[model samples]
Target: MPRFYIAQPLAIGQLVSLPEAVAHHIQVLRLAQGELVTLFNGEGGEYGATLSDIGKRHVSVEIKTHQPREVELPFGITLAQALPEASKMDWIIEKAIELGVSGVQPLAAQRCVVRLSAERAEKKMAHWQGIIASASEQSGRNRLAQLAPLQDYKQWITQQDMHRRIILTPRAEQSLADWARHQSPQAVTLVIGPEGGLSDAEENLAIQHGALPLAMGPRILRTETAGLSAVAVLSGLWGGM
Candidate 1:
């Protein structure tokens, strides 16, 4: 069954019209009336519906049943990544959602190559949010991931975080898998550096502000790979996988 993210309230027995983009998608896909589809509103669970009406530029569905099911991880994981070059951040956000991350935080670190001004950052934030919804639909997640506005690394580091912060770096003596194995499952905010990695000063500053440094492995992963890999490692060890 096809699944979609509806950014509104969904209830059983309610007849709902999809947005214009979704209507267009139904047209392009040639889905016929009476065909079943799944819809979620990010509040929780999912609704089962059938395409009740299909038009040239309109599509409506009658929600029939509700399934109180969720595939979220038991522990919340937040990816706090320094901006990378080009579209790597997009890839990271998509994969992070599929991997069951609860949130994404983009940071502008010292060695980051991609610099977004206030205007560009706003556009990027909106763009990344679309990725979150799309990824949620594809990954069978009824809830959407939280996307924090981009923050400066220095400023973001000084702020207090409720979840434990772990900075992934090559210099850390303990590997993430090792450290995670010995600990109970809990929420964690992962700090990943940019392409050139976090500067010595930035890493030291992170350590000063209660961020634990941990290594991925002997081989250094790229900016995009490190965070995803760390999430995978945590999922594997922490029983979320």
Candidate 2:
């Protein structure tokens, strides 16, 4: 069965017309009347429905049953990632959703290769939010992952409030595994730098602001790989994966 994110209040027996965007998708998918599909409203569950009606300009479904399913992680995790070049951020966001990350924060750091103007940033944000929804549906997540607005690296470090904040760096003596082993936190924030990684001064500033410096492993991972790797490691250790 295909799953569609409805983003509206759903109730059993109610006949809801699919939004124009989703209606077009149903048409493109060539779903016939009476076909089964799944609907979720990003309200902590999903609904079973059938294509009750299909017309040239409209598609409708009758909500049959509600499944209050949830697959969130044991602890909230946010990826404070410095903006990488090109479409790498898109891939990172998709994988982050699959790994059960609670949210993502795009950062503009000293070494960032891609800089976004306000107009372009808005468009990119909308684009990334679409990726988040699609990934959530494909990954069978009941809730959509939150996407925080783009922030400057220096400013963001000062505002983080998570119980645990781990900054990924190759120079750190403490490995990520070592950091995870010692503490139990309700939420964890993982900060990953851009392609060139964080500068020495930035690393020290983060540490001064309560961020723990942690190394990934012997080899240095790319900007995109480091955060996902850390999320998977912490998730597996803490029961999120």
Candidate 3:
């Protein structure tokens, strides 16, 4: 079935017109009146609907049945990823969404190569958000993952508050399995570095802010792969995947 995401809340028995973008897609798909489709409001609920009318400029859908479904990952995993090269960040965001991350935060680490001005940041954020939405739609996730504004390592560390905070480091003696041995947290924040990775000072600061150093395995993974790997492992351990 075709799936579309609506930013607004959906109610039972209410007729709603598809947005301009979705309208174009509907027309391209050549779906006629009374054709079944799925709509979601990005609020953990999906609706079964049928096209009531297909006009030249608008496509109207009538709610047939509302199914309240929760498709969230068992554990909320927030990725504080250090900024990478242009296309790499985009790839990271898309894969992270597919892997069921709750949120993504782009971090400007000491060794980050790509620097974004305020305007560029806004544009990049919009681009990444679109990728996130598309990924959610394709992955059958009703709730859209959040993409936070870009922040530097120093700035982000002071602002985050979570039950479990961690930073990936090769030198760390403690692994994720070691750290997760006795306790299960409602939320976990994982910080991964850019090309050169986080500096020693940044690592110390993250530790000061209650971030446990976690080792992924014997081999070090790239910045783009670390977060997705963590999400899959964490989700599986928590029974979300």
Candidate 3 backbone collisions, by pair: none
lDDT of 3 by residue, 194-225 (tens): 99789999999988988889899898899888
Predictions: Cα RMSD each = 0.7, 1.2, 1.5
Q: For model 2, what is the C-alpha lDDT against the true structure? A: 0.91
Q: How many Å off is the CA of 64 in candidate 1?
A: 0.4
Query: How displaced is residue 165 in candidate 2, in Å?
Result: 1.2
lDDT winner between 2 and 3, please give it: 2
Over 4 Å off in model 3, which ranges? Answer: none
Q: Note the clash tally of each candidate.
A: 0, 0, 0
lDDT of each: 0.94, 0.91, 0.87
lDDT of 2 by residue, 1-241 (tens): 7888888899999999999888899999999999999999888899999999999999999999999989999889999999999999999999999899999999999999899999999999999999989988888997988899999999989874845788999999989988788777469889999999999989998999999899999998999899999998898777775
TM-score of each: 0.99, 0.96, 0.94
Better of 1 and 3 by TM-score: 1
Candidate 1 at residue 177, lDDT?
90
Ranking by TM-score: 1, 2, 3
